[model samples]
Target: MMLAGYLVAVLAGLFAVVAIYAMLSSLPNAPDYFSVVGVSPIAALLVPPLGMFIYFLTIVLTGMQTLVFALIAEFFSLRNALLHMMFGAIAAVAGFALIWPGASENPERWADMGIIGTAGVVAGLVYWLIAGRDAGFRRPLFERA
Candidate 1:
């Protein structure tokens, strides 16, 4: 259960963060795409390529953060939504910092970071919804399944 939950939680976080990042990054009026039938499909079409690119970057940049946080949670038995959210935001921001080679040249660097951090929070919430709430629970070895 723990392994399954962990995998689902991580995947959920990854997808949420990437989807949100893609939506906000590519869409001019992102909110309109949320419900309008005409544009929603178009926006959906944009996600896959961007998602793959961002997914790879996220895995490379934030992988350590994710692993460290998961380890900390496992050892400390952390199940707090806030902690997960914090971890997600930190990981995302850290990833952004790690990836941007010319941060000084980019005028909108902070804006991108803000978007990513917000998405990370949402992702963390999604993770918590699926798995984080029961973090670090260990059944007794002798207990019957």
Candidate 2:
């Protein structure tokens, strides 16, 4: 599972980087580094498609990450990895929500970035409630030395 996670993350990150590079190269009259940081209507127009593309890619990556992490935790016979992955996913979603508040508030928005946090929470909670016990819910037999 760890191997799977590693592979998926590397692949997805690589693809995202390539897409970003392509988008940057295709821009007309690209701004200087500092200028890129400032908000402009024109810039927003240029960014939406790329942002949507990246966000979709990120969602895929998160799904892959969650699956790989869960598999790893199961293979290692440890329950904590599930929690870690769940919380990590939630954090990622929250970060996106903060960055795209309008999307977060509006379900019909294009990217639906705002609901990521909520989805993460629901997924994690549901998984925990349903399959957590089988994945090592029992108390430890003895304290580690």
The TM-score leader among the candidates is 1
User: What tens-digit string does per-residue lDDT give for candidate 2 at 1-145?
Assistant: 3334333443343333334434544467643431333323245369888656654555554655456556655665565535744654454465455556676557554333323443454445445444433454345688678
Off by over 4 Å in 2: 1-62, 80-114, 136-145
For candidate 2, the lDDT comes to: 0.48
lDDT of 1: 0.66
User: Could you give me the TM-score of model 1 versus the true structure?
Assistant: 0.63
What local distance difference test score does each model get? 0.66, 0.48
RMSD of each: 6.0, 13.1
